[model samples]
Target: MGLFILCFLTTGGALDYLYFDAFTPSGPTLPAATLFSLGAASMITLAAYHGGGSLILGSLGAERPDTQIPEHRELRNIVTEMALASGAAMPQVYVIYDPAPNALATGTNDKNSAICVTTGLLALLDREETQGVVAHEMSHIRNEDILLMTMVSILLGGIAILADLGRRGFYSPRAGQRLGRKTPLLLLPLSLLIGLAPLIGRILSMAVSRQREYLADATAAQYTRNPVGLARALEKIRDAAIPFRGATRGTAHLFFTSPLRRRLENSDSRLAHLLTTHPPINRRIELLYRMAGIMRPPVQNTRNASTRSA
Candidate 1:
């Protein structure tokens, strides 16, 4: 929904400026504006949701599981079991060669989805914990979180890119002529909006990511019938203390936990909390423990452990 609205706003804003310059001094005809806004927004939404998954996978160096290997076969089987439990179609599976204990899901919808896990995830977690992580990723597919997140990430990047271009265009001599001297007022407001859209879009996207992560965690507990499994998996992940070599802040929100090591691990400041893509690790573990009818206190030094072997 936020993605759709941002798309409409950015596209509509562009159209309005074009129409104002080309067709009428006032603005484009209402009917034309409406039609163009809807059309552009629809196209962008589809492109972001449908094509964005492959872009993400490629950027992260994820590849289809090498099914001939016993370990790859086991991973595929786990994904299939979780998908069946969730009543979602089996999704394509990928393996990230990185030695970080993390996994993420992608694709536009359940039928089109893919799941990728790091080699370290498979190496470090035992069967039950691996199942728990797979269940968590499957829950994201079942709830359509992958589609929303992939689209949001693309849209946020688009907002930033377009805003930069708009700023450059605004300062051009052609732009000065396009908006007459009397319309300098219009230029100021438009420029400010274009500059701010990226920052605003990023904050909103991060908030959405956090909320969806919480929901996916709960759904994973339901699907696995074992919140403790996920809780332990998270503990193992936290204890590893290794940064995901492939992770950038752009795709951090997609992972089972924040993929960067110690980036925001100890910050409890309100601003840091709000900017984080995932809820605090221990907080997430506590919620899972609650689901399992346990009330364990958060361990204070979960992030201090040495990096685990892959």
Candidate 2:
């Protein structure tokens, strides 16, 4: 929210400077224009926040899973088990027909939330692994990470919208006249800041998302009492060579794993780490195994250890 306000001020100030001559003595006062911009941005952001989950699910083509299918039925059962274990209300369930293995939870709160998974996930993971994934999502609901993420997504959108408006203002006849009078040195800095605001907001949003994912992994282990199940699930997802066709930059962070796969996601470089949405998959898997008090091993060996631990 603080980030959104800062972006609002920066972008709004740029627009006011370009179009309204905010610094000129005869023009509207800078403080008044700023207040108006802040008010407008807040309303748009609130509306988006209220409808964020539905918008995200609709964009992904998520729909209620057909319970006639055994896999779908099992998914609901696992959701119920995890909900009970975590003491959260049963979230509405939906499925995407995409052939990429991924899942997400979304809503403003526990009572209103929904969980959606891909058909590919049902096909790829066994019962235990499915439960593990479901538990991770349930942890998101129980911890109110859903609300946190929803707010961040909306704020990022708000920044992008403001940036677009700023771009449009630059081309307007009135703005061009005002620009002629303004010092070139003053305009340059404001233009550059407005252009870069969205990129900065995205990097901050991804950092928040990565931290929440780590927390969700730990909470899922506590709920299921089986960290290895989630560890193995992460390993499989990491190795899967499929692209999520429904993914977009705006919605990628909502998924269990990053829907848009990039080679940098696996890189150890600090710059690479900042550019990725989620933490390195291998790092997440290793943490889950550590929670289980076991050294990470090959998939088959981990399976045997999982069985023995169970």
Candidate 3:
């Protein structure tokens, strides 16, 4: 959150210098303009922070699961069970109509949270696996991972918006000459920072997301006492051929796995690893197996023996 605020402030400062200070000859003094810009940016940030959950759900087209439907009923049941197990309030349950198997938790806190699953997740996983998946999401809600990720996402969006504004203002015919004249010493560095802010914010978001995923996995195992179930669900998600059509880079980190069909996650290179939102599926599975005190199972009957043991 601190990092996100810093990026937002940096971008906001650049905008103030480029447009607020440069364009208005009789405007407020430089310090006053800067203060005003920062204050405005802070208000926007707080609003986005508080409302991020609804924004994410709306962006993903998440809808309340119809309890009249059997599958949706079962999904809600599993969510309720997990909620009780985690000592959290019953979160609103939602479903996405995508074919890709994925799930996410969102909201500011446990009482105000939601859990959404793809249609494919319901079709693909049996009751036990579904419980594991729901448990994972529930863990995110309980641990405040939902709040953290939502805020990061909002900040990332803010940085991208401010960066675009800075970029356009710097290159504009009138603003460019004025900016060059007003603060030539700061121009080059500020331009570079604005240009790179989005990438930098994305990297930071991914890094934080990856670590939270591991924590959620462990917490889920604790909640379910069945790490193999989540491990199996993850394996199915990893091998599923269909990608989520609705997923975008901006919302990719919120899912149980990366929803975008990118091969970068499979590479062994350090940079590729750094850029991914989730840790490697195999590594996560191995960690789960370690938690369960069992040897990793073979592919064909991975669930049978491990499920029994767990």
Can you give the TM-score per candidate against the true fold?
Answer: 0.83, 0.90, 0.88
Candidate 2 or 1, higher lDDT: 2
What tens digits encode model 1's per-residue C-alpha lDDT throughout 1-310? 6554655466457535632452445554564543555665566677877798998999999998898877789999999899889999999999998888899999989988999999999999988899999999999998888988888766666566656766677677676666563356666666567677666776776788888888888998889899999999998887776789888766888888888766574356677577888888888888999998898976755335322221
Candidate 2 wrongly placed segments (more than 4 Å): 30-36, 173-175, 297-310
lDDT of 3 by residue, 41-79 (tens): 677567765788899999989998988899999998899
- Residue-level lDDT of model 2, residues 1-310, one tens digit each, is 6776777777887777777778678778555546766986787567656887887788889999897999999999999999999999999999999889999999888988999999999999998898999999999999998987876777777788878887877788777677888879988988887888888888887887888899999999999999999988888877774669988766777889988877667655898679888887778888889889988653433443464589
The stretch of ten residues in a row with the least summed lDDT in candidate 2 is 298-307
For model 1, the local distance difference test gives 0.78
lDDT of 1 at 160: 62
* Candidate 3 residue pairs in clash (backbone atoms < 3 Å): none
Error of 3 at 285 (Å): 1.2
Ten-residue region with minimum lDDT total, candidate 1: 301-310
Most lDDT-accurate candidate: 2
